[model samples]
Target: MDWDKLRIFHSVAEKGSLTHAGDVLHLSQSAVSRQIRALEESLSVTLFHRHARGLILTEQGELLFDATQQMVKRLEATAARIRDSEDGVFGELRVTTTTGFGTLWLAPRLANLYKNYPSLKIDLMLEERVLDLPMREADVAIRMKEPSQADLIRRRLMNIRMRLYASPEYLAEHGTPSTMDEFGNHRLICQQAGAAQVAAGAELVNQLMTHAVASTLTVNNYFGVLQGVLNHLGIGVLPDYIIEDFPHLQRVMPDLESGEVPVFLAYPEELRHSKRVAAFRDFVTDEIFAFRRSRQTE
Candidate 1:
């Protein structure tokens, strides 16, 4: 098949209008329409249903569009890899992780990365949903659990636990809870049961709620929980990783903690030789090491 015609057809199907696709492809509307017609003739299939409003893809068009989309992603990934310098990393790196880790841990430490690779462009996507690494949804991922995706090179970064914490002032005024039974005197701040979170975290919050706490505050993410604790709103259930960054928080009832959650850093196996991915992987590893060292000294 004619690659140029296929490309034009893909663009037209995506935009749902020949004029719009022509605008993007820098081709005249007549030229784009001619390409689409030629492509349909070669394939002997109706690629689109033309209507007064716009073009709608037929079943065959949908299939072709899917193939073209994959082709585009692969080409972009290849281009990024090519743009990366062997001696110095450059180009865009899409890194993804949970909101808590991205905001509290990774994002704050990114200054060092930028300092080392000034040319690097980082797109940090923070969300609870796991992005498809192999499909190029994201270039790298630091996940709370081991990634089960195929064709991924994964390494266990660290283990974290959901632990109870409170501000010094809050503890001083309300008194510390030495045991689970004493939790009744304090407000329990945590992620809501239905919120998108690791199962272990939600389970820990569930366990704490059974203590008959007098008051409660539930936030969707750990960032909000941290805010509530810092403001002395209540005792919060938060990941232990925050302790190094937030030394002012005091661990409440040291014995009450959730099961350990393993943290993993992963990238697609195809990105093994990518300098950008290597730089980011090394940066995160170095940061984790520094974090561990600081905790040891404390």
Candidate 2:
């Protein structure tokens, strides 16, 4: 199995034409065809189905293509690690976290990081999905719960709890609910019953549902719920940390909240010495420290 042939085969399968693959590989079409033939002969399988429109992979070709895709991802991961080996720290860093936190919290504080390292590039991926840090689905993650993934270095950043909130204007219009039973007079906004969210948040919303309400609004994420609350749509269940930035949000039932959801920052153990990882880790740590200090001062 020659690596060169596999490389050419991968390009040919992707492009669906020998001429196109040849163009990318800087080889003649005939030379690309020769390599494909040699690979198929060695493997004893027809790798493609030729047609008027384009080439389509046979069953075995699909298997080979999948393997090559994984290989490419692994190679990219290796290249990233090698590039990050430099202590200069001026390259791309992929960061992943929940949509609500990424958009509402971390994204705003990232300016300080960029101010420190002007040339640094950040690819922030915000989703509910848990990325595979060790396999390099993302370079690092800030998650509501500690990552259970093995071979990762993790640090507990902080804890958050879900609490009810409403804009002051909305309260001024509809008046405030002074008791749990008084919630029956206002519309309640929250994450949909089965949407992806931390257990504590869902649990708190679920408990709120047990009580009667005047109306109901359900969103899939906290960002939308925040919008609804801010616009005077309804009372929303939101994380406590958001209050630091949105102080105008009046707390409803200040004594009621979800169980503590621990926040953690994690990266692959192999990236322990990566300058990019170190830079991001320190930036986040400094931000959290500042956040904590602000909380105390208030």
Candidate 3:
């Protein structure tokens, strides 16, 4: 019930060593051990199993630790909200998105965001895993599909399709394919069928492979696939959004493409008023608009 003791227990459970937890809490090892002992006495339960290597949490400790972790996340979110100023956006803003989009798109455009809010610190998490925005795992997310997560403010950013592309030199050397049958002449570069990717993308690759392509280069992410295409390896199945930034890539078989995948930007409802979140949301929206305009002219 004591907040101080619970805080110490959470640290110890996380670190699995009294000394390590003590160092983090700025307390002596003896002091940390004493606090843990007192907490166990009050709860009348063994929280950890002491071993020569390190402490392991007991079943009860795991439950308590889970609760503490949630509590900490909530507290941190609250603190961040309190620190945000209406007049200026500053402090750490955790943003999550797929590696392909982050590397090929968002990361390159971040200079504009920095120019506007120089004091803002952005922690960009690039992975396929969808982080829990409501649980505070990440402050904002740009996902390939509509987020089914509840209690979040969601915006449809844009729709993207997977299309075939190759370097001009590669097409010139290999001769551009006019149909699915002609695709067999060139090596195909694409994300592996088993890799984590949008279903539409995987489906497009599957369709292409049915043509009995003679050679292939598969990467786990679109970034690698783009690299392979850029180096004149072969025609690659890549997101259409990439073509705007990589104008050197010529679209192959314009009619052959994947179904549209809707991109969404989302944040927890609680973060709707946070200046940091608002700033990021607006920046992404503006970029999307600019991208659309550029594509129209092309």
Candidate 4:
């Protein structure tokens, strides 16, 4: 399929009219229509149907629209990455990080990065959702789990440990569970990263040497989960770095320990050598580890 034709189809789909798409692309309506006609001929399927109101996509067109939208986005992003690679410190960065770190830690330091390099634009997308780098969902990503996808370069940003914590008041009221078996009696909070499959609990159990049951408050947001635990609502597992800031929450059964969670900085393997990417990657890796070790002292 012709890439240019796809671009024309994408514009028409967005604008709902060939004339409007032509205006957006700086082409004539005839040219836009020709591209669409050529595309339909090549695919041997009608992508759009003429309507009195404007253009309506056929069922196949809807599918084509979805795929084309992704294609255009990835192409634009890949181009931006290439353009940014030329200059050591300028251009846009679409970075993705989990909600907790993005809110408490990253959002603050991001200003400093912009201050130091004003030319570089930063789009900080924070969600429990892990963006797909291969699909150009993000230029850089910081995630707790290691990247299992092929053709991605990953770097360990920090080794993070998690512990069970609850507010003092809650512990007093509910009583702290001292052993793994006692966990069954307590209300637990769990964080589920957006519909993506995360590591199984059995892996965590093996790592932490504890058994975990189904949680009562199952939340997808990290900040909300942390707040619930801090408010003495329930016991939840959190990165040690997060709980370190709130002294009110005490570690429940410090001896019932979980192993360290590895935080990673990852991007597509093809783009790792880009100057802008390398700079941000190294900067974050240094800052996060330093932050982690500092919390160890407290």
Candidate 5:
């Protein structure tokens, strides 16, 4: 199948009108129509049915849409690869990571990456929402949990340990809680939404009520929770990455079990062979593994 014809078909399907597709592609309306017609003939299937206001995909067209999307993406990445075949790494590295990691951890190290590879442009998105790499929403993801998708590649970056900590002033003023039973005596701060597991159509408020411990302050984010603890508002469970060096805060209990949170780096399985992606993945894995090893020594 001609890729140009498939491009026209995909554009028409996306824009829902031949005129709009022509405008987008800088082609005449009749030219767009001819391309669509050629695509349909080559496939021996009716791709779209005419409607009064817009075009609607036929059953066969719906089936082809999935394949067409992947084909177009691979083709674009291939062209970019060809153009960037010189000495240095190039093209946009679309990375998504959580806000705390992006700010405190990755952003600092990214300067070295940019210094080493001046041609590569990085677009980093810091969000709690998970982005699908294979779908091309993001080319790389540093997520808290490992992805379950069979088509994606997952690499364990590190295991983050979380421990309960409180500022010295807060402990002095409110008194320290030495045991699990003493949890009720001290104020607690936690994420508002993740406090409880709620079923669909269940009462959201009720879940919060059941899960939320009484706090001097309620936080909307992980960093906010850390800030609350830093400001001496209350005790909070903080990742070792953020709290490891703080002098004012001390572990809440010597015996309280610390929990491990696994971090993963993910990308599309197909793009493993892409030079830019492979270079990035190997560099990140080495850097993080080195960090983990240094921490172990400390």
Candidate 6:
């Protein structure tokens, strides 16, 4: 019930050592230990199991820790919203997206965002995992599929498809695969069949593999596959959006591509008014528009 004690308990549970938690809280080890003991006495429950290496949370402690973790995330979100109300767009914006979209598309265009709001700090989390926006695991997300969470503001950024491409030199040297049957003559670069990816992408790779490709190079993420393609390793199955940045790459069998994969930008509804979130959302929307315009002219 005591906020101070709960805070200390949360720190100790996170650090797994009273001393480590004390260092973080700027309290003496004895003080932290005393607080923990007092909290356990008040609750009449053992919160941690003490051992040689470190402390492990008991069942009751785990429940309490989960509640406190939620509290921490919510408090941080509130603090960020409050700070946004006071100043220019100047704070950390945690953005989550797939590694392929994050590295290949979003990260490259962020310089302009920095130019406009130089004080903004971007914490870009690049992974396939869909972070919980409502729980504040991340402030914003750009995902390959529509987010189903009900309490979020979602925007369909664009649609993308997996298409085959190869470096000009590679196509020149190895020759282009004019038909699906010719795929066997060149190496096939793609994400691993079972790796986390949009279903359309995997299906595209599966279709290619059915052609009995001569050799293959599989990477866990599209970034690595792009590298393999750029280095002239093979014809790669890549997102169509990426081809704009890599104009020299030649599309193989232009008509062949995976079904559409919708891209969405989403954030917790609470962040609708946060300047940091708004700035990031606008920046991405603008970039997508610019990308679309550039592609139309070409």
Q: For each candidate, what TM-score against the reference?
A: 0.96, 0.92, 0.98, 0.74, 0.76, 0.97
**Strongest candidate by TM-score:** 3
Candidate 5 ranges with C-alpha deviation above 4 Å? 41-46, 49-53, 80-84, 127-130, 150-154, 193-212, 216-220, 244-248, 269-275, 282-290, 293-298
Steric clash pairs (candidate 1): none
lDDT for model 1, on a 0 to 1 scale?
0.91
Model 3: residues >4 Å from true position, as ranges? Answer: none
- Candidate 4 per-residue C-alpha lDDT over 92-164 given as tens digits, one digit per residue, 9 for 90 to 100: 7789987877775677677666766778878889876778888888888988789888889988877666567
lDDT of 5 by residue, 1-298 (tens): 8878888888998898999999999999999999998888888889999989999999999888878888877776666557546556787888898876777577767766767778788899988777877678887888877787678988898877655678998898988887645666667765565532112202322332354355545555557777889888888755666643464578787564344568898888766666677667777887787777766786
Best by lDDT: 3
Give the per-residue lDDT of model 2 (tens digit) for 212-296. 8889999999999999998999899999889889998999888889999999999988788888889999999999998888888
Give Cα-based local distance difference scores for all models.
Answer: 0.91, 0.92, 0.95, 0.77, 0.74, 0.93
- How far is 124's C-alpha from truth in model 4 (Å)? 2.0
lDDT, model 5, position 131: 82
TM-score, cand. 2 vs. native: 0.92
Per-residue alpha-carbon lDDT of candidate 3 for residues 1-298, written as tens digits (9 for 90 to 100): 9999999999999999999999999999999999999999999999999999999999999999999999999999888888874568998999999999999999999999999999999999999999999999999999999999999999999999999999999988999999878999889999987889999999999998878898999999999999999899999999999988999889999999999999999999988789999999999999999999999999
Q: What range of 10 consecutive residues in model 2 has the weakest lDDT sum?
A: 80-89
Ranking by TM-score: 3, 6, 1, 2, 5, 4
Number of clashing pairs per prediction, in order: 0, 0, 0, 0, 0, 0
lDDT of 3 at 245: 90
Q: Give me the overall lDDT of model 2.
A: 0.92
TM-score of 6: 0.97
